[model samples]
Target: MQFLFADCVLDEERRELTRASQAVSVGPQVFDLLLYLVQNRDRVVSKDHMIESVWGGRIVSESTLTSHINAVRKAIGDSGEEQLLVRTVPRKGFRFVADVSEAQNPERLSTDASILSLEATKPSIAVLPFQNLSGDPDQAYFADGVVEEIITALSRVRWLFVIARNSSFTYRDRDVDLKQVGRELGVGYVLEGSLRKVGDLVRITGQLIDASTGTHLWAERFEGQLENIFALQDEISASVVGAIAPQVELAEIERAKRNPTRCATAYDCYLRGLAQMHRGDEEAIGEAITFFKRTIEIDVESASAHAMAAWCYFWRKVNGWSTDLDKDESEGLRMAQRAVELGRDDAVALTRGGHALAHFTRDLDTGIALLDRAIFLNPNLASAWFLGGFLRTWHGECESAIEHFERAMRLSPVDPELYRMQGGIAMAHLFAGRIEEASVWAERSYRNLPSFLMVVALLASTRALSGRQEDARRAIEDVQRLNPSLRVSNIADWLPISRPEHIAVFADGLRKAGLAE
Candidate 1:
């Protein structure tokens, strides 16, 4: 059925809307709300009725409903003030006030609504309830909460379609075929996991599968002490989403790669860059930067791409791979500033751009503030927490820095950058005068990545402070091997240590460890 009103046609068959012969981009929820309003044009549908029909009776905030309503009006070229079509009936609900005529058949091709309704051609997934292996009713409740949190986090990814918890939970405790679940849920992928509790520790295992093919895409296990149940749940949610997001994107990228004739879009270029960046090698990072640059050229307002390009430069500087430090730093700073300017509310942009700005400009406060805003926007973003921890460590917030690092580590336990977070913890411990703990973490970080200059330096300092002369000497040798130019006198120039006391302590340790003054 097609509804025509005020130069706009809403095609129910295609799940599309066109205004003045031009396609109007509308979100699924917004489109559903508009259709519901038009179908009940003769009556003022109450909020309860709208929620039941449009949102499947899920609990929605007033702001969310209002925003969808506003989007519906904007799509139809109407407004709250004018109320030319959709009108708010005060305490009642909404009514489509315009004349609507329906047509049984249209000339346009009738595409499958299954593909069209799934985020307008994007891939969609449903996260099934994790089985409670402990057989305890309380554990089952906890598992449900974990799934709910995972769904909430996945919803933040703009490119993916997430089935609502209510819909996904309908398969709870039911043994169903993966392909059947896919067809029933109208999704391409499904995530199922199991939760088990042992003593004061909880273990959660999750696996992502291609529902249509019954092929496993990714799987991982997370275990942590239940010191604080709520915090643990948050951590598991972050880790699950963080791991799953990249796997899903990589799967999509591979799918796109398989289609040799498909033209590359800005998003395709961005995804390719993301895959390269995750490789974390000098040459791969350089290639990632090129891909991101191509993305920017294709879409000039690609804030995340710009931020990633700047971050690649920062990565080069950190690893001493910059052939021309001055040129790279300037270019990186420009992109970082541009990213923050264009992406005030974008969490990824703010996190990467803020960290790059902090590194290139040495403006620790601004960088910390921007990262804090990113955390506020997306608390599950592990990079924001860990990177913010770095700035906080330099800013002399020792305890707070440690908490951030721990939280980040928990959020992505298997993250390739785990070494970085380990090094951050060592730095924080060293600053707090915990030599033994610092040495332990520094050694762990050095074992993970021996070439990491900061870890080597921290190891030398902590070993020297702990009165281990021979071990400190070996670490000092490794540090000089990594960066021969680094000296006790130039500690401040090497790192952004803003606190005089922290600087004094770090330099004193390096001096005792045999670095030249």
Candidate 2:
């Protein structure tokens, strides 16, 4: 018998596997494993069944079995990350997820792999129901509610594909292997946790795992009073989603980078762009723009890509790295507008594009409206919250701006852009006439990113306003080095302070700190 699939031919009588007419040097066990998977392509082959059939019921260590599976995949140009052909079924078994046909001279007919491919080949996750460890049956509902809320929260992430609760709950109370769950549910990551209730206090523990690799990427514990069960549910859900999103994003970026460039997809290019964007340096931002441009070329309607590309220009402008200011502004606004037009429901696109509009067009009202809509779409999105806070600060909504910044910090406490959030809080304080608070936050932000122009300016302004002459002078020196062209006279052009009084506050500090008018 002979089977042909994905340019590889498996011959049973001669016991040979050939690719592009060249024979593959597979070991006996690997050959048998491949043959068994191909023969059972109509269904998943359980690990036990595979061991019994291939290893003759002998005891085989997990590492040995994994090695054999890897060998088979390598022989056929498949990888664990890609899972293009051989797929792992979490808590289930393995399946050959490829099309196969019998050779003309074959004695047996070929069965097509029954499992269909994922509709969207993006990063996907499944959230299982949290176990109730409280020793009370009534606590199950609360645990279930937390899982449902997490699923709902994760669904709001436009870039993530989350499994529905109905499908995920099917494995309730099942002691399933994480890798098996990944294969069965066809997800890259899995979130599992437990909840415990004691008197008026509740404790929840959660862990995020790379299902394919069975690697625990993140784990944390949350404790809160259960005075209001629903409120506690909301808090835990937000915290879990906020912590897991960044980890999953980082894992996806690394996976995309691992794939060969020759086979890079639009999603892969976008992920690479995001990776570069997080570096937040001049050269890295330029490379990020290039990757985003490539993504746009491949997928012109990619709203998030357009928004990110626009924001790259905004970053360059704010950091004083743009070599062509007019070109950057024009191109940035064009992309930002297009992103808003295309992605009315995408929070990330709306957040980045709206900030660009606020910075480049000075349409603060329109920008704030877009950001508010984004928050409505995904309330847990930290970027939307922080960027909205920034616009509010420029628009003289000092108290409201501080609230938004605080909310963003709560959402993503260890965010990569923590310094930006800190800077926003400082600016709000400076505008609200809280010099001591502004100085503390600005100094903390400066320590994280010394070259951040706004933070440096804030430090100088707050120090000068608080009568710290020498410290203010040092901050002014750092500011001058970061942006040599900046002066007190042209502060309005640099920052769009809507109120004349707010501009006066910023300028007075700079003037006091020896910035020439």
Instruction: Find the candidate with the highest TM-score and give its number.
Output: 2
TM-score for candidate 1, residues paired by index = 0.68
lDDT of 2 at 49: 100
TM-score of each: 0.68, 0.77
Model 2 CA lDDT for position 218: 93
Global lDDT of model 1: 0.85
- Model 2 misses residue 186 by how many Å? 1.1
Give the range where candidate 1 is weakest over 10 consecutive residues by summed lDDT. Answer: 108-117
lDDT of 2: 0.87
User: Cα lDDT for residue 53, model 1?
Assistant: 97
Q: How much does each candidate deviate from the true structure in C-alpha RMSD?
A: 9.2, 14.5
